[model samples]
Target: MQFTEDKSRSRMTLRSAVPKTEQKPERKQPVQELPYIKYFGNIYYFTDSIDCAIYCDKILSQVDKTPGNTIIGFDMEWPFNFQTGSGKTALIQLSSTIYDCYLFHVTEFKKLPKALTELLSHSNVRLVGVNIKNDIHKLSRDFPGINSTAMLNNCIDLRTQANITLNCKQNWSMAKLVNHFLRMQINKDKRVRNSKWNVVPLNNAQKLYAAIDAYVRITLVEMGDKTKVFQYNYENNTVDICINIPFYDSVEELTYILIKRHDLPIYVDKDLIQKLSDFSLQCNLDYYDNSTTELINHSKLNAAEVEDIIKDWERLMREETADYGEKGCASDEELFATAYHKLVHSPALETMLQLEYMYAQTVRQRVNDKDQQIKSLSETQTDEMNKAVDRLEEDMTEAEINEIAARHFDDQTLLQVKLTSELETIKEAQRREYREWVMQMLEQNQANSSLPTPKNSPLAPVPPGPIRETKEDRRKILQSVVLEESFTIHLGSQLKQMHNIRILSADVMDFCAVNDNEQISDTTPQLLQTALGLYSNDLCGLVLMTDSVIGSRLTKDFTEICQRSTEFHFPHIDDQLEIISNTAKKYQMESCNNRNSSSKHLQPGDVYITRHSNLSQVHIIFHMVSDDSLRANDINSRHPVVLGLRNILKTACSNDITSLTIPLLLQYEMTEEMTVTWCAKRAELVFKCVKGFMIEMASWGGSDLKNLQFLLPQGISSDVFQSLTGMLPSIFKVSNPLILKSSSIVK
Candidate 1:
C-alpha cells in the first residue's frame, strides 16, 4: 500500500515549488451573456514556506470580504493506498467564485494557518463539494484536534442537493455534475488523479487538475439558479438541456415544492379539503391522491377497506365550500399541510395515550402532596396559637396584661389580624411552590425514554416465540455441542477473587445510594455498593446497561452517580456523559437509538466506560436494544445481548478491570414472560456464547481470565437452577493433564 519515491531529500526541496519571479495574470471582465458571470480563472499554490501561506491568507481574506452567499468549493487529496486504513490529508484545495483558486500543501504547512481555519469555520461561508462527508471524515481521522473544530458546518453536498432537485438516482460525482449542469465535460485524467500529492514540487499539470476539481463545484452552484430542463443521455454519458422546464419526481412533491417556492395556495374548495384532511388524520397516514393504491397494498387492507378510503376521498372532493370560511387561500393550504405532517410522524394512538396517562399521574401525585401539606399546616396553626397565648400568660402578670389589653384592644385585634394574614401568605406560598414543582416536572418529562417496549409497531406483526426446551432437548443441545478451543467456566459464590465476574439480579431502574456513615455511595442496584465493599479504596469497575438518551428519570444508582458527581467531589461523574458521547463519536457508533435501522443492529458495538473518583473505580455503561426491539416485559433481543458481552470482554481486555459483575438475567426487572423455562433457555444461550467468546477472545484482543461466576436470579426455582448447572459440567472443565505435564516439563 506504501507509495515509493526518491530517498534523497535534496531533490524534494520546498522552495523549488515556488516560482522565482512572480507574474500576475491580468484580470478580464466576465462575459455578461454567460449563464455564470464568474468562474475560477487562475490558481495560486502555497508551499511549506511562511511567505506562501501568508499570501494564501491574504487571498482568502479578500474572498471572505466579497458579497452575498460566497460559495467556496472545497476538497482534499492524498496519495492512494490499497489498505482500507486512512492516509494523511496531503493537500487542501479551495476555489472561490472570485475566479481565484488556492492549493494548500498540507504536508509543507504541517498545520493549518489561523486565518485559513477562521475562514473555513466562518458560519457565513458555504463550503460546496461532492461527497463531502468522506472528505470531512478523512480530515477528522488525519488531523483529529485541528479538524474536530472544522465540522463542515453549513456544508452543501452537491450530490445530495442534485438528488433532491433533479431526481438523480445515482450519486453525482464532480465529472457527472459538470456534464449534467454545465453541459460540458471536464478533464478527469486518471494518470493525474493517481499522482503522489505528497511529492514536494507538484507539477503544473497536477496543480491545474486540483484547481479545476474545486472550481467546477463553485460554477455548478451558480448554474443551478436558472430554470432548465435536463435529460440524461446514458448512451453518450451527457445531458440534453432545454430552457424553462425542470424535472419532477412526482406530482405531489412538485406541487408541494411549487407551493413553498412561490408561496402559492391550493385552489381546492374548503368542504372537500376538510373532509380529506380529517380522513387522513383519522387513518394516521399521509394523504396523497396518487398514493391511494400504494397505501392499500402497504397497509394490507382488504378490498372493502380500500373502497372505503376511495369513497372517503371522493365524498370530500365533491363536497361544497359553503360550510368553510374561504376557498383558494393560503390558510386552507396550511390547515391541510399541518394535518399531513402530523399523520406522517405521529405514533400509534395507544402510545400517545400511555404518554398522556404518565403525565396526568405525575400531576395528580404533586397535587395530592400539596393537599396533605396544606391540611397539616392548617391543623397545626390553632394548636401553635393556643400555646403562644399560654406562654404570654406565663410571661406577664394577669393584672398587667388585663390593663394593657383594656387600653389597646384595637392594637391587639390588629396584631391577631396580622398573624392570620401571615399564615394565609405562607399557605399561598406553599401552593405556588407546588405549582412550580409541577412545571419543573413537566419540563423534565418532555423527552421520551428510548427504553425497550413490548408491543410491536403498527407496520409489523409479532413473531411467535419458540417452544420451551424440555429436559431431553437440553441434553441434546449439550451432547451436540463442540468446541474449537478450551476455556474454564466455574460457578462460585465468593466475590473476593481478583478477576471474578459476579452476577446479580437488579431492578430496571436501580440507583446506587451513598453510604453517608462511611462514605458508602448512595446508588441504585445495591450490588454496586456490595461490589465496591469488596475493595477499600482499590480500583474496581462494573458494567451497566442503560438507555442511549440519559433521561432525567434515572435509576437509583444512576441518580446517585449524578448526585455524588455533583454534590460530592467525584470528578469522574462530571465528565461521564461527555466521555461516553465523545467516544461514541470517535468510533462513529452509538448504542441503538430510535433513529437506527432494525437490520443495522450492533454494527460497531460501543462500550462507554467512566471512572468514579468517589468509588475509586470505573463504570462501564452498555446500551440495551431500543424500545421497538423488545418483545414483552423489557426482554431485549438476543443480538444486543451477544453484542454487549463482546463489547464488555473487548473493553475489559484493554482496561484495568480486575473483576467485573453483571446481571445473569440480562435485566433486573422480571416480567411474566421471564419464566423459569425462559430463564433456563436464556441461561443456556448465555453459557454457550460466553464460552465461545472467551475461547475466541485471544483473537479479539482479550486478556487472561482468572475466575467466572454465574449468579442465578433469586426468584429462579431451585429445581430449574439445578438443571441449568447440570448442563454446564459437560461443556466446561479444567485444562487437560497432558497440557499441564507438557508445561511442567518445559519449565
Candidate 2:
C-alpha cells in the first residue's frame, strides 16, 4: 500500500473545471395552412326531372368507370314540418371526386314519394352524409328498409367521424364544423325557407344550394380522416370511430330508431273533421247565396255576431236537454238546433187564434129569483091545503097530480084557492116589485141595448174559474241515487264478542286461568279478553321492572334478550301473553345457583365444584358480590365471582364442555339444603321460594325479591363468574359476602 497522501493531485483536479455558457430560447413555429376551396358559383343547377335524370346519369357513368374505392358524397333534403302528414323531400344531392356535381329533383320522383325507399334499396351505392339519421327518418316514411346497421355499415356519417377524430368538447353540427374547420359559413336561411321541392319548376338558387351542401359534407369526411382523430381499422371489417355511435342498416331499423328519437306521427280522426266542416256550413246557412240575398245584405249584425248567437243558443239547448250527452251533440246537430229554436221563438211570428163562443161563456152569468120568491110566500100562509097538495105530489108526477086535483075539485075550487090564498098576496107584492124593477131595467136595457153590451161589464160576462195556474200541474223532481246498493258486510255475533276485550285490567292472571276452562260457552271472547289483559300486564311490568331482577337477568348479562323482548311487535294479544310467559321462565332459569358448598357458608378461598362427564377435570368459579349499590363500582371492583366466572366461561368455551353438573350452596351462613340433587332443581325452587318471599316482603313495605335481586352461584370460572355477577346490581344492591376456612368461618 502506498502510504503517501494524494492531496496535491486532488487540488489540481478541483482547479481544472471549465466555465458554463448561457443558452438562448427557441422561437415558436408558425401554424401551417390547411387546403381550402372557395366553393363559389352555381354548381350545375338541376331543377326539373329531365335535368336531374341527366345529372344522375352523368355521375353514375363517372362512378362506374372509376377504379378502386369510390367515395361518393351524398346528402338528402326533406320537409321537416311535424304538423303536416305530407311525406316529401325537396332534393337529393350527390357528389364525388370523379363526377362534377349532381342534384336529383326528389319532388319529381313522386311529389311526396318514398325517396328513402328508392335510395336505400340500391346496394351498389354507398350513401354518406352528416347526421343522416333525421333524413333516414323522413325517408323511412316511403322506404322502410333503411335501419341502423345499413346506414352504419354501408353509409358513412362524417359528423360521427369528426367527433371521434377531434376529441370534440361537445356534439358539433355540420354548420358548426364547416365554420370552425373550413372557415367558410354557408347560409341556412335558404335551406329552411326555400320553395317546397315537391312543387314543379325548381329555381336555380335552390338547385345550387343542394349541390353545395353535398360538397361541404364530402370535405368534412376528408378532413376527419386526415386528422387521425378517428383511425379506420378494417381488421374487424368495422369502422372504429372515436365514440361508439349506434348504427342502422334497414328502413325498419331506422324507423324504430326514429320512433325512439322523435316519437311516432299522430293520427287525426276523420269523423271529427267531417263534423266540424258540417257545423261551419250550418252556422253560415242564413248567409247562403241561395237564400234571400236581401235578408243577408240588409242584416245589421255581422257574420261573427250571428255566429255568436248561434253558439249561445246551442249551448242553452245542450244544458236544458239530454238530446246530447254531457259532452254535447256533434257540432252539426248543435248548429241546426240552435237556428231552428231561435227562429220558432222570434217576436216577429204571428199571434194565436181566439174563439168567440169560448169567450162568451167565460164572460156571462144568469141569476134566477122566481123560485126564491114563491118559497117565501108559501111559508107565510096557513098552508094545510098547500101542504096536502105537496104530499100527494111526492108520490105522483106533475101531470098525474094535476089530473087527480082536477077530478077532486071543480074549476071554481081551483080558481078560489089560486086567487084567495096568501099566494095572491105574495103574487101582488112580487108583481109590484117586478113592475118597478122592470120599469127601471126596461129603461136601462133600452139605453144599453141601443149601444151594444159592454164586453167586460159584470152584467156582460166573467172569465171561467180564473184560468187555473199552469205551475200547479208540474211534478216535483227527486234527487238521483249514485250508488245502487251497499257493498259492506257486518261481522257475526261470535266475532263481535271477541273484539270487546280491555287489555289493561289488573285481573289478567285470573282472566287467563278462567279462560282455560272448557265449560265456558263463549270461549273465544273470554280467551281474547284474557290474552289482551296478559299483554297489557307484560308491557307495563317490563317498563316498571327495568331496574328489577327480571330486568337484571334480561338487561345486564343478557341484554340481547331484553332487547328482543322489548323490540318484539305482537300484532295479536295471544302472542304477547305467550312471549311474557316464555321470557319470565328464561330469566328465572338463568339466575339459578349451580355450584357447590360443603361448608355452612361460601368463602373466597373455598373451592366450589362443577363437573361434566366429557371433561377430565372439574371447573370452578369463585363467588363474590359487590357491596356498592353503584353499577360502576361493582364492574370495576374485580369481585371474586366476576373474575372466577370469566375464567370458567373462557375454559368451558375453549374446552367445549359437553355435559356439566353443578352443586348449589348458600353464600351467607344458613342451614338450607345443600345436596347436589336439591341444587339440580334449584332454579325452580328458588323462583317459587323467591316469589313467596317477595309477596311477604312486598306486604311489609319491602320490594319484591323477584323485582330486587338475582341469584347466581360461586364455583364457575372468571368469565362465567363475571357475567353472572354483572346481573346482580340491576336487581339487588349487594352489600356483603361470607368467607370460610377449612369448612369453617374465618372471621
Candidate 3:
C-alpha cells in the first residue's frame, strides 16, 4: 500500500497493487490535504470558499468516525489588542492522531460550517488543549452570544493534567513544553508569534507554527502514561504520586525533594523512634545482651560511606529534638517550690497582704464616692418634683378644683378619683422598673471593672478613670437624661409620639465646654459619668455628617475632634486611616447610566460611618450630591439626610452606644438655601423621623435608649429658634411641661 496526494482534487488516495485471492480489495482514498508541502501527515487548510468549506466538512466526518476516543489537539489564534487584552479568534487549528491536521480559517467565514461545528460540539471527541480556558474565553469574545456547549465540555487541558501528574509547572511555554516532553527543540521566533493573524494569506512559518502547537499537545498526551498518572485513593486517604525518581541519587534525596515540593512537615516523632544520641555505646547488657549490633545489618552497611550516611541522619534527628540548655532543668521545679514556700513565710507575704488591703480600701472609697453622687442627684430630683407638685396643688384654689371636678364628673362620682390613683400606681411602677434597669447596668459595669489581678504580682497599677469631667459634660449628661425621660410614649396607643422633647438654643459642640454655674458645680462629663454609672468606656459617640468622599476633608468641629482623638487618645492613626480608606474605596462611585432619571447623587440614602480614633466618637459622611447636580442627576431629598440620620443612629446603637448626637437639619454649615421657614420645616421633618427611628430602635437589635442630642445650626436667631422649638411640641407631646420648663436650661 502507498499513499499519494492529488493537489487538483485536494485529496489523498491510498492504492494497493496486489489483488486478494477471493476478490480485488476495494481502493481507498488518502485523507484529504490542502495544496501545501506535506511533511509526514496531511495538513488541510480551509478558507472562505464554499468548496473548501465542503472539503473541510468531509475531513471532519472521516476524523469523527475514528474508533475509541478521537483525540484532537485544539488551539486558536487571534490578534492582540492591548486595550482589551485580546481580539477576535482568527484561526482554529485541530490535529488528530499521527496523519491528520486541519486548519480552519474561522475569520474568513461569517459563521462556522455546520459540519465543523457538529464535530467540535461532539461529546465523543476529546479535544486536548493547553490553557483551554483562555482559548475558550477568546473564542467566546470573537463570536459573541454564540453557544459554546461543545467548546468547553469534555475539554482536557494538557497543561493542567501535566502539572498534577508529571509535576509540570503551570503556564509552561509551548516551546519549553515541546522541548521537555517531545525531547525536541521547536523554534518559536518572536516575529512569527507576534505576527498579525488577520492577514488573508498566511505565511509558511505561521502555518507551521500553528500546526506544531496543536500537534505537540496531542503528542504530549500520547507520550504520557494515563493509568499511573497521579491517581487519588479516597478509601485509603492517600495519593498515588508517580514521578521520575531516577533523577535523584538515593531514596533519601528523593524523599527530601518530594517533601520540599509538596511543603510537607519534616518534624520527626522522637517518641516513635529512639534517637541515635539516646542509643549510647555503653548499653545495659541485661536488656541489650549483644543485640545492638544486630539492629544495623552488617551486609547493608559494610562500606564506611553508608555507615556515615546513617550516622548523619541519626545525628540530624538528635539535633532537631535537642534542648541545648534553652529549657529549665528537672530540679528547677523542686527549687521553685522551696523558694515559693520561703517567700510565703517571709515578709514578702506581708507586703502583698498590705497591698491587697490598700487596693480593697481604694475600691470601697471609689464606690462610696459614686454612691454619694447618685444619692444627691436622686434626692434633688425627688425634692424638685415634689415641690413642683405642691406648687401645682397650691396654685389650684379649692373652688377651681371643685369646678374642674364638676366639669369632669358628677357630684357622687368616685370613678375620677379611682382613675387618678391607678394612673399614679402605673407611673410609680414604670419609674421603679427604669431605676432597676439602671442599677443592673451599673452593677454589670462595676463587676467588669473589678477584674482580678495576677496572684504572683504584688503591685499592679490602678486602671485609668474616664475622661476628665467638665461643665459641658454635666450639661450633656443632664440634657440626655432629660431628653430620654421627655421622649417617653404610651406604648398601648397605636400612634407613638415623642412626648416632652425639649429644645436647646446652645451649640451642641459646647457639650465639652466649661460652665461656671455656682448652684450646679458638677461638669457635664461628671454628670454623665454619674448618670451612666458604668465603665467610662460606655460613653456616647457623636455622629456628625460631612460631605467628603475619602474623609480627607472635614468641618471645623469634626476636624478638631479627630485631631484630639488621634493625637492625644489613639496612637494607631495609620491603621484607622487604612481601614477608613479601604472601606471608602469599596463604595465605588455610581455611574449616571445606572442612576434613575429623577434621582441621582449616590442613591439618596448612601451613608458611611466610621469610628473615630478617639474611640469615643463616630464620624458619619453623607453622600450629598451637589445642589446644581441634583436636578441633572435626579437625586431625592428624602434620603442621605433623614434616612441617613436613621442609619447613623442604628449604627451607634449597634456599636453599644446608648447615647448619640446628630444635627437636626443634617447640616453643620448653614447657607442661604436654609431659610427660617426651611429650617423649621427641616427641623420638624427631622423631629418626626427621629421619633419614629427611636421607637423602632427597640426592634432594630439596638441597646436601650440612653441619651440623644438634637443639634441646631449656630446661625439660627431667637425667632427662628422659637419657631423650630414650636414644631417640636406638635411631634413630641409635652406630658410633663412643668418639670421641663423649670430645669430646661437652653444654653
- The global C-alpha lDDT for each of the candidates, from Candidate 1 onward, is 0.50, 0.37, 0.51
Per-residue alpha-carbon lDDT of candidate 2 for residues 1-747, written as tens digits (9 for 90 to 100): 001113653210111011111122345232233333445533555566565555555445544554433456777765555577454666667766312456665555543223333344344555667777766666655543445455445565556555433444467676766665566666566554444766655555566666777888665544333221112222353221221111112423433433343343323224323433343344345234423442453232235556877889888887887775376356733443333233223321111001111121221210013234434444434253465567774765667656655644564455445543443344344334323432343345446532223223233343434423234223211211111111111122243201110111121112112111122212123222212222121111111112222223212332221111111111222233355446645544544334332322232322222111111111111122222231221122243433433333233333333212211122221123433334333323333333233333323431111112222332223443343333323332233345556757565
* Deviation of model 1 at 739, angstroms: 20
Predictions ranked by lDDT, top down? 3, 1, 2
Candidate 1 vs candidate 3: which has greater TM-score? 3
For 68-182, candidate 3 gives per-residue lDDT tens digits of 4556789888777677776567889988654456777777666666666666767667677878877776676666554476667657766555454343367766655555445
**Candidate 2 CA-lDDT value:** 0.37
User: In model 3, which runs have C-alpha deviations exceeding 4 angstroms?
Assistant: 1-502, 511-539, 552-557, 565-575, 589-605, 612-637, 669-673, 737-747
Ranking by TM-score: 3, 1, 2
Cα-based lDDT at residue 340, candidate 1: 26
Query: lDDT score, residue 256, model 2?
Result: 43
* Candidate 2: residue 371 lDDT (0-100): 30
Residues 498-592, model 1: lDDT tens digits: 23343333232222332222211122222333233332323344545554553223323574443331211122353466665565554444334
Predicted model with the maximum lDDT:
3
Clashes (backbone N, CA, C under 3 Å), per candidate, total 21, 45, 15
